[model samples]
Target chain A: MPENMTHVPYYPGCTLKSKALGYERSAMDCARSLGFEMHEIEKWNCCGASFPLTKDNLMGLTAPTNILIETEQHCKERDIDAKLITLCSFCYNTLKRTDFAFREEPGKLKTLNEFLNREYKGNVTVIHYLEYLRDVIGFDNLSKMVKTDLSHLRVAPYYGCLLLKPQKELGLDDPEEPVILHDFLDALGCQVIDFPGQVDCCGAYLIMRNPDKVLELSHNILEEASEYGAQTIVTACPLCQSNLDQSEAVRGEMPILYFTQLLAVALGLETEQHQFESHCIDPKSLISSCKKFKEFSDAK
Target chain B: MQINTENNQAAIRDLEIATGETISDCYQCGKCTAGCPASMDPSPSLLIHLLKLGLFTKAVNSASIWDCMACLTCSERCPKNVSPAAIIEGLKRIHLNNMEPEINLNSLGQEFLAHSTQQAVVSGFRKFV
Candidate 1:
């Protein structure tokens, strides 16, 4: 609560509040460590989880638009910049794309605003927390803050689909060959691995309808990461984490973690903040092993 | 496989309106199919081809529509920017509007429901239901 500390409006979405508490907790803690406060938007609703694919589905745009309006008000009340940070990749994509849609079609914005009895000037810039780290806080500064040596752990940065698809809209990174996760992980002192399944789909929402196909897809991603000698896999999407973590075929073989959790660890935050137990495949042992090796080598 | 030009034209027009992508822009480059990880049969290119050939019914009937994960790899790889992924989603919207949801929430086992993330359940209902 220092006077000069930056205040960033945040949207936790549905998953972060319910299933992805670890992702939320770690991200907030890391933001504080990095000298920024993530202010949650009061009375924010769901970002609809998935962006409505149909061009005519303005009804689907309402949920995220409401969240954006709330973010704008949240920033206004605090006298901060109109930037809303999202943790969940799905929420990031939905809110970002919703903002993009309104920008593309001002008429649609007018229709939605009039219908909802609210005015959103499209002033809010929706960004993922990773973007904030890379853009706002340079990786150089982040590397300087790393208190733990994670060089012993080889991590795979999984982009999945939401973070980098439909490049025209999201444009977070190269949808084909992304390096933000690599750069972020590198700054954390971990060895980053480049794997094929990094940007591939982990069967996404298909898990609900076709769990078998999801298993096959998630298994393929895990196998590829394992083949690349990755000791752990880090992702930005809650659904991707769940699908990859719940792969019955390779359960407990590879621990799938949110990128923020690893950031919390590298920042030397309290263990409870990472919420390791919430993960389907607990990464506590893997993380502890890495720490133990660091200690053992230091002792040598 | 009788090709009904009328229905095909209507379907194509509907899809263009829904997705805002020109169907004729696709030239069957196969890059979308090659890059797809979902193992979609009657691949994305083939579905676009079917629409071009006035085989709207066949394209709509293909089970591959459901198999699409909406990863947007095909859409991103398309040289013509046809966004076959969006087209497939448009097809899904059309299909869903006409039929009952294929997934029954009650039929899902308790364990699966318990472990699935809220994002999955919400997005699952959005896409499947």
Candidate 2:
């Protein structure tokens, strides 16, 4: 396993390990197929999604700070400073903001390291898998490796906050008009459709406190996608998927899929390897439809 | 000045220092309110207006503070960079610190926990508690 020698340390946050199994499986498989290998850290913990905007709160910083310390140690053992890959957008956002706090603010970093009993600086860089794909793997190369062209599919790319917000440290693209997912989906041979609700908040976590708000937000997104002729909405955040994927209004409107799942399917991985079973709306119909298209195209 | 009014003034002063953003900087532009996705009753601008006037009671009483999704849309579009999202968070902290509302952890498990990630529950506790 030559890839193992240079394996990049991967952090699978709580959601990916439990609820988003397919996201993890498909992301790893797709990364491997693209010539990048992800090695999960032996010890990792959840990065609380909502980063405390309060400057005086040290307790809020503990969880993400400890995860960074562990990741630093993981990279040290491998003698590699490769970036830590995160599969979930919320995790990516939380970790990235915390990491920035450590690097930019010396006073906070000193106090956090002292509390954690580790002499760690901001050594390990945290990046979302989308960044890994776009920056590291190169979308053009990714496009060339497609086994089943997804040209017949129309996908709405939902960024659902976090990936680009606060505009201070975590902004990955033009917050008003991001095209990272647009180019990525197009490269995979899928027609990317433009929708206004693509960047709207999914009323994240409000599904608990305010279910109606979440339903309204999720329904708006699904309705917009359906109106635009999108078959499924692809997203990078597990929270966004959970909120939008299986709501009563969105259940049959359109299937919500992790971008990695789509990549794994396009890379010609067996259906069993991806966890389409966990999805509420059932993406198997969409996958089978693509398979039928592949078979029909191959026959000609 | 009445003792209660003095305390309210102190609270606003402390909040300004804590958030490192002066309410005076807001200038009643309403840009934050216009861009806010969660904008509704007691709009972001309205909350800021009350906060600038040192009306902590009215600001905290409004349910809109809790409704802020922390999407930062207002922050991104704010002409003065006045983060209504951060202000709302500060208001929640003040509420939690004052009211000492019993954040029944059990209440979190009602129905949403089943669908939510552990990260969300943990973060929600960290922010609210």
lDDT of 2 by residue, A1-300 (tens): 235434778999888888898899999888777777889888877777678776666677888888888888888887888478898877888888888887788889899888888866688788888887898888998888787868889999999888888657876787889999998998899999889989998878655467678778888788888889899999998888888875634446578999999988887776686788888887888887775346645765
Q: After superposition, how far is residue A271 of candidate 1 from its true place, in Å?
A: 1.6
Q: Which runs in model 1 stand beyond 4 Å of their true positions?
A: A1-3, A248-252, A292-300, B1-6
Clashing pairs in 1: none
Per-candidate alpha-carbon RMSD to the true structure: 2.9, 3.0
lDDT of candidate 1 over A22-41, digit per residue (tens): 88888988888899998888
Clashing pairs in 2: none
